[model samples]
Target: MCLQIRDIKSKVIYCSAVLLAVMLGLGTRAYGDQLPHFVSVHFGDAIWAGMIYLAFRVLLTRHPLWLSLVLSLCFSFGIEFSQLYQADWIIHVRSTTAGGLVLGQGFLWIDLVRYTAGILFCYVIDQILQY
Candidate 1:
């Protein structure tokens, strides 16, 4: 039987996780040149997905952790698939700094894997934190 994670998660801890993930994600992008190619290429997307999980945790405090994980996966996958649409407005949005960061310019199948791994990693972290 699975225990409900919502009862044990603290909003402050989730919020802090969100902030840390953001910093690490952004730092991965910013200092990517200095990092190993594998990490630079992979960790950014993973951290982004992890951050989304934490954000969902913070916002959906009453929801089960599995729900947050599902939603985070859906949200991350939705954003990745959205890159397939090349509308002028969206393309333009993806061209800017903020837009490019938020809405990636290109879609890669590997990103789906990264998101899954990252979310699952965070989910495990959340579970462990419950102790």
Candidate 2:
């Protein structure tokens, strides 16, 4: 049976994890050039998705784990799919540093795989740690 968590302790931990994920994500992007080609090209999106999963933990602290996992995938995938629409305004947004980081410039099939792996990896770790 799935159970909701609504405790202060859990909230604090999840919040910390979210922050850590964000820092790591930014750091990865910042140092991408220094890393290997594959890691730089790939790990950024994976880390971003992992950050999303951690953010979901913070946002859905009262929801079941499965709910968070499903929602995170939907949110990540939705953002990726949204890239398909290239209205000028959205394209302009994508040209900026923050917008490009958040919305991404283009879509890649491998990104879907990276996102899935990142979220699932986080979910599995969360389950093991939370229990």
Considering every candidate listed, which one attains the maximal lDDT?
Answer: 1
Task: Give the CA lDDT, 0 to 100, for residue 31 in model 1.
Answer: 100
Clashing pairs in 1: none
On residues 74-102, what C-alpha lDDT tens digit does candidate 1 reach at each position?
Answer: 99999999999999999999999999988
Q: For residues 1-131, could you state the per-residue lDDT of candidate 2 as single tens digits?
A: 23333466677888888788788778778898888888888887888898888888887787889888998899999989999999999999999999998899898888899999889989999999977
* lDDT for position 35 in model 1: 99
Q: How accurate is candidate 1 locally (lDDT)?
A: 0.91
Clashes of 2: 0
Candidate 2: how large is its RMSD?
Answer: 3.2
For each candidate, what is the lDDT? 0.91, 0.86
